[model samples]
Target: MNSLWSGSERVRIVERLKATLAGVVELELLRCKHLEMVDAALEDRASAAANAAELPAEEGIRAPGSTASEAEHGSTTSRRQQVSAILKVIRGHIGACVGPVFNPLLSPSLSPGYDFAAVLEWFAERVDRIILLFDAHKLDISDEFSEVIRALKNHEDKMRVVLNKADQISTQQLMRVYGALMWSLGKIINTPEVVRVYIGSFWAQPLLVPDNRKLFEAEEQDLFLDIQSLPRNAALRKLNDLIKRARLAKVQAYIISSLKKDMPSVFGKESKKKELIANLGETYHRIEKEHQISPGDFPNLAKMQELLNAQDFTKFAALKPKLLEAVEDMLANDIARLMAMVRQEEAAMPSQTVKGGAFEGVMTGPFGHGYGEGASEGIDELEWVVGRDKPTYDEIFYTLSPINGKVSGAAAKKEMLKSKLPNTVLGKIWKLADVDKDGLLDDDEFALANHLIKVKLEGHELPAALPEHLIPPSKRGSSLEA
Candidate 1:
């Protein structure tokens, strides 16, 4: 719900840059019309006040400098002041109300230091020059920077690529990275044979810590100490370009105006804003068909959301029992398959004196008092009994209370499990199981968690789990030896 991202729930954003641009054009026109209306009304009101004052003079019934005329004049002046105040408010709104339409650009070709390459390209398009920076340490460009890729295609001549963090790598590595970059940018962007690539670290100056200090090569410790020539040349080039653009900016405006005359509205004005929005929808549909943009493209956003939601331990604890049952159900066949392998392994081992292992362990943990109802796990085959590829959150949810696979009355079983564990552990149990912080864990994590719930928290019989691998910290070494 925060305004940082896709906050405009009412509208869909897509391939409608021109539609928004047209709105920008008409917005100015509408503001002019509205201001004209206000000015005309004010003039008419002033004229009426003057005419009323003149009526008394024409009828010869007004005294010199009458108080009534003065009061009427004061009222007219106050009304004008109110009109000006209203206009000021409108102007402020006009400047600030375009956020919903102007955020979240579609771009690709990302490098480490050039995070804003896309936005800079958009700004570069509106202006005359562009100075793009990239970390020399990060050699390759990512496919996410679609905007940067497009900019290179269109404005390669106008861009100056600065190779930042020049001191991070050895000169040999730097040269190789630069060479690879040059080849890649040329092949990928298909720019000129040679585009400017300056070498400097613009903002890496700070007292280095132990971990980060080792990053710089020995010879590169004070590299580019007095590197100003490239930047100065770039500045001079910009100055020359600025003077040329300043002289011809008027002609450019005229050309833009002529182009606007030919541009037609994407939809009619039944409601102009609504029409533009509908046009954007159509454009998106077409774009979706041509270039598929999937949710996978924004995995980081989904990851961040999952992390934020995981912070709410109370809600997670409430849902833990249902989630556990769901996952246990989903992985039922897998578990059975694993248990068979474990049994086979146990049979392969040399026969030993039937020491009190499962019987003693189970009777001690929450499994005591006949809470556990499963075949005892074979010795030394605990962890392998459950396969890897940790259970994802989706599998757990779908298994227990399948949105599409729900059971009619499974709450009773969950209540039984809840009864086995203490109130304290059950309060925030999900945190114990979600070991990887990716909002999921495999069956091993689940087994270990349930074991802790019964044995550690409730001091009851530990249920079916990895015996030695998931033993309590104090007894783990002994369990391993035995």
Candidate 2:
């Protein structure tokens, strides 16, 4: 068996497990709430029944010969059933507050027709923010992720990337990957502002392997502070879902009423039904554009319809009070409970992690010792600081194109270079950078290429920390803007 296949299989299995675990934890929380709601509803109903029982027989209970009290009792029973159905609707909607990347194999409705992009857009509508997480061992942004970054640049205010599993790599490796990641992110988002990148193991505890024992032990709180901070949306997302529910309730009432118009009925009852229908029409028109949400957004609408129709809502007019009460409970307690939890978690978190890396300029360290530095340094202060060993030409190539090191034997590297540079300029870059006729760029060559991109193509000054000798002839005597 191929070792790579086994490792990939393990990863797939682990992803499935995580998705399943998330589903279980969320459902368990909801189930507990359901049990509590059921007990409260039952207790309240029992108290009401007991109160009725305590009333004088002549006042509360109809005499065996009279039917008015029996009719009232039936209405009360029907209302209780309506309350139960409404509770289910509230429960179903509460779990989907954020997008859960569900497996299509588990349920097609999650990524319906396997259109994950469309599903992602659907999720984008619901969420106020997005977390883009990746492993620290391989922090290089790939082509696929570049597309995501570009697509989400519109929501850049809400974006933050978590570089997880830092404990899996060495300090030197972590620092190198971190520098590369920041550079890649700057290019992707097309921004000078540094991207927020939380660096730590996201697991309960960082594995104390020899690879990262030093940094893992040094950072006390680890990723907890950052994870807690990521969800800090300024305002709680006020879903216009309430309007949709109101529209839905009115539509259902109208439909149920219209279905009864042809039936044999007393003139007085028929007139009342027509009046209620007209009122519902007016209410629907008033709220039609109040919210862009629709009943179609809820996946289990078929089941919900069954639940709504499951009871004897034939007396729905009488049951509206209980239905409304259930909605009120959901708004006050159920939805509030979850939103409050998120807000409290955010509030309790210490203000340490950077949100979107507002203040973090390009960081440089020991790897850039030979790099130039002087008083009043500006752009040059940002140095190439990967490690003690200078980066290789192949490393630079691989960084530019994932296909560079692949066994598939593709000309992806050439294509990548072309994409970044014009033919006339690229030929000049090749002559200056690749000093050896070996068709590869070494550290000197790599630095030269970067300098070309920064100065010539991007019209940005080369980092002043770059060794003065490495500066191309054209940029040597030119004065740079701060």
Candidate 3:
């Protein structure tokens, strides 16, 4: 009887182990299936987005809603809403370092230019610069690279080329490679020097030798000299100046064209003159609000004092109608003055340019535009255009049609908020709507709220500039005013 009991216990143990192994296998399969589903969804969404982006502008699409009106508006609005949501979520998960967010190893290529180009276009409307980094050892310039380079050159002087992997090659080899790259690239692009290259392995460190202080010091000096000899800093300054000038030029051309179109109507009748004056007043108010300054505050000494404290000469210049219309030309003159100042500053310094800001490794190519999810080092403040009253992400995406797909999840929430009045404006309207001081909005509150926004558009002052009180006093100057 004892022998039989022992045998049964051993058999039970064996069965338990089998069950545990089977459970692990099942879990793995489930994970694989989930990943596959995610990939398929992403592919479908990407294709839809691409098609929507190409749709003609005549189609009037409302924001994404379940209603027939939204569907008829075509998929453009839906796509943008979807993309924005995905990006927002992806951005949030970037630093988590846990599971595969997007298949990191899906593409083996070090620098995929086509993928990079799409990213550039998305950022073009939002930022002034885009930097691309490459592993010099694996550098293979493809058609995609040419396309990106062309697009960047045409857009403005904001594209920078960074060549990485310096520690892998000897100093002599690095210099030779740099020269070869510059010579080959010089023929194709206007500014060969703009393709900045640097050599250093983020993963590798120089070997330290014990009791060899002199040798170590000599090696360090050599590295410093090599870095100094690189022309990256000079190249970046030139590029920044070039981009600023280009932006100014584009603005100038637009103003001139607009003025030419409007010149005929400016000289009509007394009635026309009155109408024009009203239009001009409205225009002035719109411009002031767009710059986030109060309409009443303008024409007041206090406002001018505020402007001076802010060092916002650009906003001051924008207020003048002649300057507003000719903003491009005005900006061009500003750029020229800025360039002269930079040159003067450089000349005064022993080092031609300060090795700081975004230009630090300009020549050595250490600064590449390739930023990973977990790798963004500094604060990223994005400035993009939206209509008066601080349009929401949904409104901007619907207007621009930058991304193409069905909006979902957190993106939907953000878009919903964006479509409504801004929080500050909403808060003000809510205050006016809520006759009772309770926090929640009931039926009466909702009806009154709608009425307020309708009237708010007609005569309401832009929401009190996002209060500086929200920001720490030390950082108030840098915070974005809603």
Candidate 4:
């Protein structure tokens, strides 16, 4: 068995296990427990890798000159023991018996299809979800298991296939593999229900992992603060209070004009006054009918007349603007506070982690070090300190901006963003900012940032203004004049 498989094969297995373990952790976060079998398989592989790594190096030993073959045999035994240990852990967690496992390359006498079918049956009974990890470098399973794959497609939502060792395969081969997998899956399941196929390299640096971890943790903290600052229930209560104050202000204004004493003259004739009083009753009834308020809770016509006799319109008029202003202030303060909390949370986060060679340009500092000042001169007076200039549109779009329009109106700035961004990043930004069902983003749509901030604080109105410079170039002319 040791002679049959190379060191590269073992390494590939170890890589797959690591990838699976990471996926398991992610699934755990999402509260999905259906991948217990896959998790167990991953644990087994990880233990084997650890055991292999721990073995003493036999660098100087030769097969004939030393006991190197014996040592290698012992290592192999240890590896098997590690694998068994992992399998035991998996079995314990799975709580069910699985079918016979076979090595397709070594076990030439045994039929791969028969073994695969048996395993599938075992999984169907004992596992809630199935994940097929294939070695694209070795056998092609798509053609061999076309019928079974079709059958599995009926449960595509419950299954996924990972094309392992994608980095080893040529681009054309990878596409052909993907196409075959998709075609086979589509035959078994509806297009919408088909399971996803991921082409991943476990050894490759994750595109977002460390940075996303920091971003998500910071986002969670911001979310908590946002929730704490503006409790929805409490805001609704305040809204009701503001509405009541507005109604009272309107009522007080009518009384201050001395209109109650000459109600008949104000309304018209005596009969008209009565009609006007009746109209108030009708309005109250209409409110009750609409379930906005209860007529029984309001003052009766005669009681209302008495209250009006004592009311002062000047006081009401004076309070009206104040109440409105109070509501506006409360909303604005809460919104500003929430935004501050978010910005503070983001600011405290570590600088974004750079992943892969692709992000190197973005991660590199504005200019090379030592280009500005030499270190030994105790901050030489001759050396110029970098000016605190605001970020340019290009800098903001490329280095500082999120790939998705999470920064607001980022998609609308695509032409500007394209100057320095990759097409993949721009595509993601477009998807995020083109939220309105319309494909394009206009200046009005660009104001979504302000809208989001206002809505979060229970204020429906957008901010009084956006910065004139942030306005799109085409709209700036009209807006600046206004």
lDDT string for model 2 (1-482, tens) is 12323688647644554543343334334334534655677689979976765565747754563366566567656755664575467442211221122223225332222333434454544554567777777555656556556545344655667777887877888889888888777887865567676676756674744565434423323333433343454335442333334334544433444434433454465555444444543433433445333433222323333333322223333223344344445444444444665467657765544433321331234323222332112224344332212355346545555333331113323633644766666566555554444566544445555555544554333333444455434344541421
Residue 57 in model 2: shift from native, Å? 24
Model 1, C-alpha of 227: deviation from truth (Å): 12
User: lDDT per prediction?
Assistant: 0.42, 0.47, 0.41, 0.42
- Sorting all predicted structures by TM-score, with the top scorer first, yields 3, 2, 4, 1
Candidate 1 least-lDDT 10 residues: 94-103
Mark the regions of model 4 whose C-alpha exceeds 4 Å error after superposition: 1-87, 92-108, 111-116, 136-139, 142-154, 169-173, 188-192, 204-482
- Higher-scoring candidate on TM-score, 2 or 3: 3
Which candidate has the highest lDDT of all? 2
Off by over 4 Å in 1: 1-122, 126-128, 204-482
> What is the number of residue pairs that collide in model 1?
17
The residue pairs that clash in candidate 2, if any, are 380-463, 380-464
lDDT of 4 at 233: 33
Cα lDDT of model 1 by residue, 94-140, tens digit: 01111111123322221222234444443454433345556777755
TM-score of each: 0.23, 0.27, 0.28, 0.26
